[model samples]
Target: MHCSVVADFFSILKKKKKNVFFCYAVLPQNIGTLHGLFLFFISLFPFTLILTTDNNYLFTKKKAKKFSFLVVWVQFFLARKKISNSTESIMDNAPAPSVYIKTSPRDSEVEKAQNINSATPFVTLPSLPVPISRGQCVVYDQEVLICGGLYTRDCYSYHVLEKKYKKICSYPKDVKLRGHSVVKRVNSNTNDTMLLSFGGYKNEKKHTLTMKYVSVWNGEKQTSNCNQWLPLMDKNEDKPIIIGGDEDDYDGMRSVIGGSNNHLLFITYRPKNIDVFNLDTFQYVNRGILPSDNWIYFHGFVSKTKSELTSTSTEANEKKSEMILFQRKTGLAIEYDEDSKSFDFRKLSVFDDMAPLSEYAHVCINDTILFFGGHGGPKLGVSKAIHKYSLKENTWVKFEHNLSTPLSDCVSVLSEDNTYVHILGGFNDHRDEMTIHVKTKATDWMDEKEKEKMQIYNREKELEKEKNRKKLQASHFFCCCLFFYLCCL
Candidate 1:
């Protein structure tokens, strides 16, 4: 908060130097006014610091209550107003036709153009549904299947297009999970290409061993069914995390003959207790563990543009698709050595220019592993700038975007084309509560390219809107003049 305040002060001072100097006129009689303003701002600083800083105020229930109330009041007065203003201050529509597609550089030509872009989005949520789960959600086939999570009890699934979300019917009345894996099957021969949900909290009890279940939806019958809960092949031991689960269709006849969709890789927290489970064969093979905690936050996503384009609808045109696993907890990278037999797990690096990525948020698109806002340093809430790690270049590319406010716990999801990453819901330090934050502009490399086009288009639309206003005024004036002339005649 201090850093943000200082940065803002510098920016304002730079832009309005005269005004800043004028403030210096807080001399003599105006000294009282300056002092009062300074005192007011000092008082406005959040009270949370008082708890951590002042030992005298620590460990008192009565004082804590008072401090909590003070913090809430400050957020209600200052932060809420700022957030509310942001929604109305920005233009939420696509750039006007004149701005993006202009006839000439002339102001008149730009101004005369009409805006053809729609303000309404192609998709809109009726209401932000009561989010049931958090960490690593999966959108399989069509429905978004969110498993056991950091928050909430029963797991739930929501249809992306239908806007309908209900508790997972197959999910027992009371079951909770943490560190689970959810994968979607794509075999065309079988009728039940179900959503494979594995691991995490099976019930209120926090069990180290991971569990597995599959949910199947019948389009014809319009009824959903879930397979019986299947425990891992090796369940006696603790910390059995089912990290990666995907059909190995690459090795030609090897995958087809093996029928290996449930090729599960299980990991224990210890240094060397990794095991592989081939559900089709009902066999468990011992594989050495990874040196680092890579598989803990690893996410396996099948890319569609490389050699193995299996599940995606546009596979034919897309040419290739490789299963991508992202290891966020370790760093801005993915390690495959312990899991995959072929490649030795190397730190999958990205563009160096886009340095210091957020360790928390990352997503896979084709050959790119995109990361967004996270606490950069050891400090609990000190998040760095946004970044994208391209698998193609094996390097990082810095993104040009600044959040309205600092936040954490936000989630990102890619649309079908993987063009726009829709960031949603997070906790802000200012508000100190969970709030929804969406990307208003591009956070990718092409932001500068889009910015130029948007500027020109906007100027044209403004001019066109102005012309319409003038025409209406002229028509009104002529009508009044003719009426007065006829009256005189």
Candidate 2:
């Protein structure tokens, strides 16, 4: 009966006998181990296989039980080998590093000059808190303050020199203010670093009434104790001539205008007027009847110029540049000259080509204004183009490259090194998520065509992996067979 069983196993092996040697190595000797001498030798076979290199004993009847044990051991070896090879192949096909923007020095000569001019190695500041979205940030001496922002109610203050957020007393919880203008009071006899906060939404429902309050923050304390919110006019009037003081609070705060000295300026969108306040006395000076444009959002920046104008009277007054107003809807600038303490109101020539995507895209970097990333108009689909407003030339220059992704509500700031624009917290197209982007050089200002190419390259690599998958499977199978043979000894 034992001999008959051996014959049946040999028939099964023959039917699958591509590797006859490997099949034979698993077979027992053609005799029963129940015989006393064979049983003794069968118990010793595993030990002999462990110590000896001879292959002749493998075919003996006494080695049958040992051979069967060896075959079970070789199966585990083959399975382990198959797993290792497959794991190795998978690791080799992993994805590349994700680098959407890479910035290096633009000019070799300029880099050399910077190296010579370097007084100390610069330490970068930590990223801004609240991740600014469509707000205004201003720096004066050592303190950088952001005021009147969207999405966030609390203001942020950073000490640029020390790289720390100043611990200041908090304001009243009920006072929800934003979308306002801030101006640094440089010429005040007592306080050189006071910011005048004007305009922005005040309450729950979006109201058309202009907000009449002005807030002052001392740069040294960064404290609300030193900060005070004062109303420009009486708050109880039915048609209160304020930016965010209407029946309900919305439509954002008034746009701020900084003067040559201690006086501050502001304008309303609904009632359409301008108002001024003296920083020293907190006096209200109303300037009546602004331009008829209703859908305008304006901002002001101080520009001082001392020049000799040769007039008929042969008398020269040092003419400081106008506190410029940027009209959001029109993309036009209205200049308020200091000579008359009134707006010169010149129409900035807007070419049909110069319409910015929206007011949200406009940002001020140092002396220049940058505009980009707009929703699609009738003709232009969601523009990724960048436009620069040169304060010196009073002209716009279009940068070559657009953003890597189409995003709005991004926070863009010039680094303390003054070498890079760090843009943070915007949408990421590749991941279909919101991601941070730090724009370090001129190349980053460009369009998205380059980033799209790298994305396409990664997809092709995945395709190549699928094409070679069959070859990988065959390689793993051979490795399993070889491992099984090694274990059989």
Candidate 3:
């Protein structure tokens, strides 16, 4: 009876393939007692066993193989069950993965989308107090200050926030400045902010190279309302540093590039030299010569430090500054590496065809450089074209939206936020101020539809001007004919 019971237990172990070693080891030890053997086999809990006896003494090859197979099979089944349960639980609780399908839109649909998003770049603003051309315009405390143009010493400040213009103190009558470059500077020692007006055409023919520094913010005042212009006098020489020379050598058509804590840099045409003015000692020093002989008709200078452009926080603390110069006439861009103290000139391929134009107003904001209307291009008279050059892409894109009025020799100032470019005092019959809301992302560049619109606008303006011109000519002819008739009688 005991033997049959043992045989039945073995059969059950084989079927279950679990607790084979526990039963096998304990049962062999208690085979002499039927009840002990039966109780041990019945318990049959899962456990590992180390047999001290030799393999040949313990069991035959067939029995050992069976035991090994049972152990592995049981472990495999248990592991698979655990894995299956985990997978099912995850699938039940987890969110479904997202899937995207892309489709291309039709050309007409794309154009319509662009049209809905696109905006006219230029907006006309209120006219200045008086019509002035080739003047100086600078932004201070959200107000634009305009001064000294068309042989007038009158200066006015336009509050951008209020959209109002108020007459400010003018420069002295003796100091006549137009076609000059004005730069705002801060004194390191006094921490005073000042405006320096330098190198301009004065008295029509005379080129005044003298500089005048006026305290814009002396900590006491918010604006340059009652500030007096102080001539930047030489310490040793006790005289004004005469930058203007012979009209042929230096034509006084100059633009202020950028300045450091110690020196201010400016570019002059005719002679084509870069002059550095020592802010500390108040003296002039010639830095380098420009490559082109043609006057720098339109020029912009911006200084960028490595820290500003760097992405990594570890390298963003670098203090290296680079000065970039843009010459519109030749489409030459030159960069001065502060570390190497060398200039790298890069020819912009996009502006190759548009280099002949001059007198365009340009301003650098962040990485973008915008060129407004100017004269002396393929589009004669005043150019209604607006060109934008991106520094990051090193590419030029012309905007389809032109200025409200075609203008040249306008003074442009970027707003404090850099969103709007205020263009003031261009060569027009009336002094018209225009604001250009620079688009962060432009949809199209001079599309066919935009071109047609610009052509129609220009044609209408030209027709009106032609009618006025013909009437003036007829009046002059009649006067001459009447004068001749009276003389004859």
Candidate 4:
């Protein structure tokens, strides 16, 4: 019986040709241990050949059991080799996104004389399906959700790894919205990232102020055709809870500073109020006022708070992030605290030496926050510089690499693995919507490459200047000799 089974197995293996390992890999993952061992024992070439040649050959149960013990190690080795090779091949062929816009050129002499800092390193990816600005966005795992923007109902999810924008369901209803506030709901139980959106001008006329009954979207089900903006429900009730809007709630763009798991902190302009909204209670817990009501745009980072349960309260275990809200014309800034509900001058050590910039796009990678192009001047002004703040070192640096042109009113977000950054649609000085994508430099190898290229650029310029100087000297000597000869004649 064993001899006949061996002949059948060898016949199958022969039909498979040289793809023996592929057959092994295709084995069902949940195969029972005893069944798998029996099959593996039959796969041995020597025993199979013996069975095929000699029908009378005695097969001992002890030998078969001993041979099956090595099957697990053999199976593991073959599967691991195949998987590792496939992984390496995929990584090697992975796409590297590049810059798309033509950067505004700068004269080397001017750059040197001014002693100006350079921009941050960036790579351009695919543009958004539509141009947008002054919208609300939040980082959720691998994607940044652009909920809604001025005069447009289109909402998009910018995927970092894929380097593309996918228009995921538009805002519910016929009314378009702009200047809204969107924040990720903390301590969410579902695998999908839950988001709460509030405070946008509906139809560019009516205000949808407050978080009382904010519209909620789940990442899992928020598809391209999904048009539902469901209301947040009460914890105890099966019915939907109406989000209440305050009469005094200002309807405009809100800057998210940082907040605890149960709370969200934001700084609102015009009124210049810093308020904290509780996630559990779905209401405002604390509110503080800013000194100047100036419309200085704020950019900040929120440390990813822990989701694990502990003895301490969630708020006590987490540290709130500092904000970089400052005026462009006047180099003044204000830092707010969510815990104390207090405001003060921004860390003067960092802001004192910083240039006045506004409307810049910023994103966090590792321990650093990168600020991109912003309002460059008085009216309709935009900038082309990239500033980096290192949270660990407490130092700021300006890199030579920059956006293709002056950019402002754009949104930027970091990837889940801290490997890429996508700067979404914004506008230029000409008021042209820049529906472009940008990536930040993440690796030390990339930095070295940029530095090497710059050195080569400088060396080439120096050689060209030296060659021009020699030519001028020769021309001068010839002119002098010609004058002397003419006088002699």
Candidate 5:
């Protein structure tokens, strides 16, 4: 029986008229373990030999188990040989991956890819419902909720992923907001996300003021096409809390900062006071007054430091704490100490020579503060420059690129990953939306040494590619010769 099986296997192998020595050379040394199973399979399925290839063999699970050891050995042998012969060739011929490095192409004939303009970096998107400015937007899930900027109660939700806009529930009948601070807060008790809109001018005259309103959308209760805006009431008073009041024109300057536990800290303009709102109780309290400086239209946000949390005993020690209020302008930054309640004003060491700018769209990304186009004086009015301030380096670098349009009062939101910044509805005549792709990091602006290293690295790659081309040519020739020899056999 064993002799018959062996004869049948060889007969089947011979019938294919393949290179027998080539097959033997490629077969794993561990083929002795699969010899019996291989013979059994050959006896069972005479056609199995036809499926064998220089690199691979196909078998069903059951048949595969019978020849498992042989399959592994064959795979190993083929993989080793292929990798040994192809490694250098592949590395040399394949296009190098894109890297964030500055280097000129070695071959002058090779066209270099265009560098993204850092100055007007924003790519325009679809226009809004109307030419709106000073609008407030809050990002919820994949959508951005825009409310009351064009002197109308026009509320719309923009689907960021779909690039489509759908009008949602309008603001309350009396509430029209522009230049408001909109924040998405979660209800700790019910765990529902709530949209909080606070402190904005009401009309084109900028006379009326809309203080605060909370809107909630229940997808289960309401249809997918509509959402209901409900007034958030103070638990004790049974009335909606008026934030900053109807008299203060705190447009474009209200900022929500850090709060502990269920409490949230909000800094508003005009009064320049910190208001603490308890999410758990729906109550508001006046905490501390900011410096009595002209804080109008200035940005403020809470920045926490480790020292602030650790130094609890004395006000002097608390001054060393990390909790700070960061305010910015074109050439100025005012830092407020949260613990000591002191203000420290510093002229921006860099870009101080540039004209002072205001009403611009700004967003904090990672350790950098990006200032988009804002209004400057005559020479720099409605500026298009995109200035980036590095928090770590304490320096300002103005990007040579500019915005597509010179804009002010544009709302800017950084994507969750900090890859793109979306600017919407600025002072431009058309409600043009734009996105700036944030690719180059602060460190990627290479110096001389880095640029030289990049050049050397690219040259080495070219040499490797040349070597690979030769190896591939040899491999093709060897394969062709082997094929011809097998055919003759």
Candidate 6:
């Protein structure tokens, strides 16, 4: 909280030279004004400061509580009534330690444009089924599948078009997993592909966690029943965890990241050891040992094009798919070699200009990736910046921020039509509670390449939906004809 407060103060201080003279003043006349100052002073105490500034932009390293405790103040000479005005007072969306943005007494057009861009509105979506964090969100078709999170045992499917959600059933008994891997099964029934959820940090009773049963969701089913989920359990010593356990996916094959068993959510080990778990046979067919790199934490993702394209989708796309993995200091690109059926790894040349990313959330629009809040530093603070990284350029290019404190452990998903990217559900760095933060924005920020590819995908999805509609209409007609023929007989 102090970290955020000090940072806010510095930003406010640097915004205008006018506020500088008043920084040291104590307004005792008004109790409210004095109180705001009191909290402002309070923020200076708990911070561990190593600040870097260039052209008035402040970068801080104080960890804890994500971004919390805003300190908003305005012109003191304003009448009390005017002081309460929305512009003079705290921003409605920003919470706590109120900080009102004060510009120079004489504002220029450029400053006004910058101000307008700073306050760009965040996307608003329907309320979540429940406030959740440390959970996983899978962009399944036109719907979002939200799995377990802190203090929640239920699952939910959020429909994008309808802008509503319904409970999708819960884990059996007391099963709860804060961090778990959710992946679409490669091969499945003709109706639709199924989704598999397994492995996690310490969720509820860590002792009860085992490879004994993997939860399965039938995407084609509409009803929410525990019976609908098939239990995938072939008990063995492997115990749903290898080299501990985590919720990350390896080539969309296994659920193991540095986060391991015993509720260990994020470990920094990427071992050379590898094992294969056959979804069909439910057995470890082969095992091979995995990267040396020193990243306190890291994140991995694919471009939007990678997810949309199939092996034969395009002739130019020779490599099947690519995953970009980056740690605090360096990045590695993992691509699958079709001929060898093995992954080829190499270092990414660029260094991320943004803050160190770990436990961050992102959605790829075209070839550009927009990264949201994550652990800011060693202190485990949260970052408010929404960073943009281009796959083509392989570099961090731009950034935005939320109106309020940033969240950690949040997840992001793209709409089926590629019109919007939804970022949802994260917790404060200092609290156990889940923050109800969900935002949706149109893909206007996406690059031209992504826009074009996504437009094609959108058309394909529309054609498929149309074909399904026509098929349904034909089936209904056939049923009616058969009934009339029987009556004539």
Clash counts for all predictions: 22, 21, 0, 9, 10, 17
Q: In candidate 6, what are the lDDT values of residues 1-489, reduced to their tens digit?
A: 111112234644565532221122222112355445544443444332222211111222333124443412323233223334433112231211222234323335323322323245464567676777766666666577776665676778776545678776677664546444555532211324455665434222321221111223334544442323444544664334232334332211223211111111112233333343445444443343235355323364443244343436454454344555555555665544333546556676544545365666776665667777777676647876666776667667554545256677777777655655777777666754554645545445665676665566555554555465445444544553453334335
Once fitted onto the true fold, the runs of candidate 4 whose alpha carbons sit more than 4 angstroms away are 1-120, 139-144, 159-164, 174-176, 186-188, 201-228, 235-252, 257-267, 296-324, 327-346, 349-355, 377-380, 392-394, 443-489
Point out the higher-scoring one by TM-score: 3 or 6: 6
In model 5, what is the error at residue 313, expressed in angstroms? 18
TM-score of each: 0.45, 0.46, 0.55, 0.56, 0.53, 0.56
Misplaced by over 4 Å in model 6 are: 1-121, 126-129, 140-142, 161-163, 174-176, 186-189, 201-228, 233-276, 283-292, 295-298, 303-319, 460-489
Runs of candidate 3 with Cα error greater than 4 angstroms are 1-118, 200-226, 235-252, 257-262, 298-329, 337-342, 350-353, 377-379, 429-489
* CA lDDT, candidate 6, residue 387: 69
Across 1-489, the per-residue lDDT of candidate 3 in tens digits comes to: 011111224444566753333323211211234433433443343433222121112333344455654553343334334434444332243211111112223434433423433565444456777766677777775578776665567777776544567776666666556445666665544435566665544224333332223423222443333354556566687876545443423323555534334354555554456555555565554466777646554455555433234455342223223444555555455555434455555665547534655677777655556777777655466776788776666777776777766777777776643335678767642335333322222223344543344344344443443455445444544553453334335
| Residues 1-489 of candidate 4: C-alpha lDDT, one tens digit per residue | 001121223544666633221111122212345434544543443332111111112223333335443554464445334443444332233221111122224334323423322343455567777878766676665566777766567777775544457665666574446445666653333223456666533223333322211122323543432334555666586655433244333354455535544455464544455565555665676666655435534433334212211235455435444454444433223444556755564442344323556667776544455777877557446877777765445567776666788887777765544445667778887888767766654442134543353344334443443455445434544553453334335
Q: For this target, which candidate reaches the highest lDDT against the unseen true structure? A: 3
lDDT of 6: 0.48
Give lDDT tens digits, candidate 5, residues 1-489.
001111223543666744322122222212233443543443332222222222233333245446644554465445445444544543354433221113324323222212335443444456777656776666665566776574657777766445567776666666556556666665444435666666555333222222222223323345442355555566577766555545556666656544443245455555455555555565554455555344546453434322224425555544332223334332334444544444454444436523366667776643456777776656556766777665546777787666666777777765532335667766642335332222232223334543353344445545654455445434544554454344445
Q: Give the alpha carbon lDDT tens digit for every residue of 1-489 in model 1.
A: 000011123434566632221111101111133333542443443222222111122224444445554563353234334433443222443321211112334445323322212231112233334443234355553445544444543444555434456555334434344444444444433334444444433222322122222433433233322433333343445324343333211110000011133344333322223344454344555444444453333222333232223334452323211333333433322222223332234445434432222324455554455565554334445353566655545555665554545555455565432334445444454434342424322224333543453344444444554455445434544553453334335
In candidate 6, where is summed lDDT lowest over 10 consecutive residues?
257-266
Q: Model 5 TM-score?
A: 0.53
Clash pairs, model 4 backbone:
98-124, 103-404, 118-399, 119-399, 119-401, 212-243, 212-244, 213-243, 213-244
TM-score of 1: 0.45
- Give all candidates' CA lDDT scores: 0.37, 0.41, 0.50, 0.49, 0.49, 0.48
Residue 137 of model 3 has an lDDT of 74
TM-score of 6: 0.56
What is residue 185's positional error in candidate 6, in angstroms? 4.0
